[model samples]
Target chain A: MEKEVILQYLPLYREALLLTLRIGWQGVLLALVFGVACTWIRQLKIPVLKSLVTVYIELFRNTPLLVQLFFLYFALPKAGIRMTPELCGSLGLGLLGGAYMAETFRSGLESIAPIQEESALSLGMTSMQALRYVILPQAATYSISGIVANVIFLLKETSVFSVISLMDLMFTAKDLIGMYAKTLECLTLLVVFYLIMLLPVSVFGSWLERRMRRAEFGA
Target chain B: MKKNQLIAAAAAAVLGISLLSTGTVFADEAFRTLDEIKESGTINIGVFSDKSPFGYVDENGEYQGYDVYLAERLGEDLGVEINYVSTEAASRIEYLQTGKVDIILANFTVTEERAEEVDFALPYMNVALGVVSPDDAVVESLDDIGEDDQVIVISGTTAETYLVKNYPDIKLQKYDAYAEAKTALENGNAAAWANDNTEVIAFAIENEGFTVGIPSLGSADTIAPAVTKGNETLLDWLNEEIVALGEEQFFHADYEATLLDTYGADYEDTLVVEGGAVGTVETEAE
Candidate 1:
C-alpha cells in the first residue's frame, strides 16, 4: 500500500529477479541444445531415434507445465529422485520450451535445399562439415525469430515455479501481498519488473533478426 | 581424460539413471529423533512462506511470523539451531514423510485422517472456516449461496474439503496460494473467499472494502505441530515443550509479539490453546 514499504522490499525483489533470470537463461540454453539436437536427428532420418525425438516433443508440449513441475518437485522426490526446486523449475521450463523450439527448428532446417549440402560436399567437405558450415548457419538465420519467441515464452513459463515453491520473482510478489495486503501495488510492481526484464530481450531479438536478414540478403 | 574413459563415465551415469526406478531413498530412512537432532545441532522445521499472520516472509526478506516465532523458541529450548524450510500448505505432511523436515509448524490443523500419517503435538491455536467478501455483496451464510455463485478456497485447506463434502452443488474456484485466492475475490472473479477464520479476519481488517460475513462456518479445530509417524520421541519432546511454554504463558507472549498487530486484544483467550488441550469443546452437529 505504501511506497516506502515497496522501496524497503527492493532487496527481496532483486534477489527474486536474479533467480528468475537464472532459471530463464539456463532453461533457454537447455532448450537450444535439445531443439537443435532433435532437429538434426530428424533431418538425418535416424530410424528409431527420430521417432523417439518426436515422442519427446509431443509428450512435453501436450502436457501442462504445472503438472510437469509438480511431478518433478513432489512425485519424483517420493520415488527417490529427489531434486531441488531450482533443478525442477529450469528442467520443466527447458523441456516445454524444447518441444516448441524443436518444431521451429524443423521448419527452419527443412527450408534449406539439399543442393546446399551437395554443393558443400563437392567442395571436399564431409556431410557433418556441410551441416555445420553451410546448412545449419542458414537454418539459424531463418529461425532466429522463432528461437527468440520461444525464449520469451520460456521467461513467462518460469512463473509456474511459484506453485512448486521455487521463490522466483512472482513468488516474491505473492509474499509481498501476504505481508502488506496491497495486491494492486504489488501486482503493478510485478508487471513493471517483468516488462523491464523481457522488453530488452524482445528488442535484442528484433535487432538480431534485422542483422541476420541484411547479412543474407545484402551484398 | 582420454576418450575411452570419457565414454565409460557417460555410460556409468546413464546406467545409474536407469537403476533409480527400482530404488527408494526415503522408504528406508529412519524417522529422526530429538537426540539425533540435538547431536547434529540443527533441526529442520517446515513453515509456510505465504500464509499471513502465521508463517510469512516480511519486507526484511526474513521469515517472521507466528509459527516461525514458535519454531524459533522450540529450537532454543531444544538446544539446537533452527533451519527453517519454507513449505506450502499441501507440502507440510510430505515434507515430514520424506524426511525433508524434522518438524512441521505450518499451521497444521489436527485431523483424524492426518493423524494416521503423521504424529501431532498439543494444539497451539484454534481455527474454523470463515468467508469474506466485498462489503456490498456480503455473503452472510452458505444457506444464501446461489447455485451460480463462486466461492474461492485455498486448495489444501480444510475449508475446501468441508465445502466439497457438505455443499457439493456450490461452485468453487480453488487456488494454491492465499494471494491468488484474495486476488480472485477482489477482482470479482469469485463471490467470496473461504479460508481459516483468522486469515479471513486479518484480511478484512487490513484491507478496505472487505468484510468477514460468515466468521465461523464449521466446527472449530486446533492447529498443532506435526512430525513423521513413529517419531514418538520427538513428538513427546514437542508435547513437553508445549506444556513448558504454556506454564510460562509463551503463547500469550507470541500473540502480543506477532498476532496482536493483526488481531488486536479481542480473541486472544479463545485462540491461544494452553497446554495442548487436544480437542475443541463439543458442538452438536448442525
Candidate 2:
C-alpha cells in the first residue's frame, strides 16, 4: 500500500467518517424510539397497531438494505415523496434497524418473569406503574448487548448510503479509486477509517454487556 | 505472560514474512500479452451493460452496441472467443489494473490522469460533455444554473471531473450507474444531467420531454480502448488494427450497424472516428 496516498486522503476520509457517524447515530436514536414503541404495543396488546407493528418488523427485517434504499431514493420520488439523500439514508437505516431493535427488546422483555409484574400489581401498583418501576429496568439491562449489536450493525449499514449519493466513507474510497486507480491504497484507508469509527462502539458494547451482566447477577 | 508474549511475537513475525512474499508476487509481471491471450483462446473484454448505443445488453440478453461490434471483430481476428465482462464506469480502471479484463471498451474517454495507469489504444469515437435537462428549464450554459439546483452525473465520467474542477460551487448528484442517473433526471431530482454529448444526445432522442441544452461543455475528447499498462504487444496490435481498419472505414460501418438507429444520420460525420484519426474528416469536408 502507498503510504503517501493514504496520508493525502486522510482528511477526506475523516470528513466521510464524521458524516457516517452523524447519520449512524441518528438512525440508532430513531431505532430506539421505534423499537420501544413497538415493543410496548406488542406487550400491552394494543388492537390493530400490534398487527401493523408485526408486519412492519417482518417487512423491513426480510428485505436487504440495498433494495429498501433504492426504493426510497428512486421509487418514492415518483409518488411525490421526494427526500434529500441524507434524509433518505438515515430513514432507510432507521426503518431497517427498528425492526431488529424491536425483536431484540421483545426478547429481553419476554425474559422477565410474570411473577414480578404480579407482585407489583398485588402491591396496589397500577399496570403502568408496575411496567415503569418493576419491569423496564430489568428489560433494559437484558437488552444492552442486543442494543449494542444493533447499533454496530446499523453503523455498518451506512456503507450502502453511497448508492443514494451521500458521500460516506465507501463513496469517498470508490471515487478516489475511480479518479486515481490506486485500489490497494484506497481500500486500506477505507478499512482503517471504518475500524476507527466502529472499534470504540464495539469495545464499549462488550464492556457495557459485561457490566450489565455483573450488575444484574450480583457479581 | 512471558510465554504469551513469545507466542504473539512469533505470530507477528510469520504474518510479516507472508505479507512480504505476497508483495514480491505482486511486483512480478502483472498483465497478459497478445500471445498469452491467444493461447488462452478467449480474450476478456469489459464493456458497459447499461450505457446504450455505446455498450449495452439488448432485450435478447445479447451484447449489442458500437463498442461491442468492434470487440467482436477484435476477438475474431485474434482467433479467440470473446468473454464479455460488464463494467461500471468507476470500476473500469480497477478491472484493467487487476487483470480482471484484458481490454475496456466502455466508452472510455482518454485523459492524462488515466493514461498514466492504463495504455490507451487508437481512438474510435469523439465525445464532449453535454447537459440534458427538462425542456422548461433548459440548462444553456453553466452560468444559468441555479444556486440550489443540482446537476446529475455518473461517477468517474469526464463530465464529473470537468464540472467538479472548473465549477466547484455547482452541486452535483452523482450515481454509479447510467440507469440510475437517467432515473434521477426523470424523477426531477436534479435540474440537469451532464455526461458525454453522445449519451445525452441519445437520451434526449430516446426519451421525451428532455433536450440537450448544452450540446458541448468541455474540450472535445476521443474515446478509445484501454489495456493494462506495459502491455505493449496488445497496444501495438490495437494501433495497427485501427490504422488498417481506417483504410476500410470500419468505424463508420460500426456506427451504421449499432449507433445509427439511436443517433440518426446527422451525427454520422461528427461522431465516428475512422482509423484513430480525429478532426481529419471535418477539416477535409470544410
- Candidate 2 residue runs with Cα over 4 Å from true position: A1-4, A115-126, A215-219, B1-28, B280-286
Q: What does candidate 2's lDDT look like per residue over A1-219, in tens digits? A: 677888898998999999999988889998888888898799779879999999999999999998999999999998889998888888998999999999999998888899989999999999999988878877878999889989989999999886788889898888888877777677767766877787678777767776677535234
- How does each model score on lDDT? 0.79, 0.87
What shift in Å separates residue B266 of candidate 1 from its native position after superposition? 0.6
What TM-score would every model get versus the actual structure?
A: 0.58, 0.90
lDDT of 1 by residue, B31-76 (tens): 6888999999999999988888899998997888889989989988
Give me the displacement of residue B286 in model 1, in angstroms. Answer: 23
**TM-score, cand. 2 vs. native:** 0.90
lDDT for each residue of candidate 2 in B1-286, tens digit (9 for 90 to 100): 3355446545755565566446435633567899999999999999999999889999999998999999999998899999999998999987887788999999999888888878898888988999999999999998888999999988888888899899999988888889988998999989999999999999999999999999997888889999988899999999899889999999999999998899888898889998998864231110
Instruction: Give the C-alpha miss distance for residue B278 in model 1, angstroms.
Output: 5.7
Q: After superposition, how far is residue B60 of candidate 1 from its true place, in Å?
A: 1.2
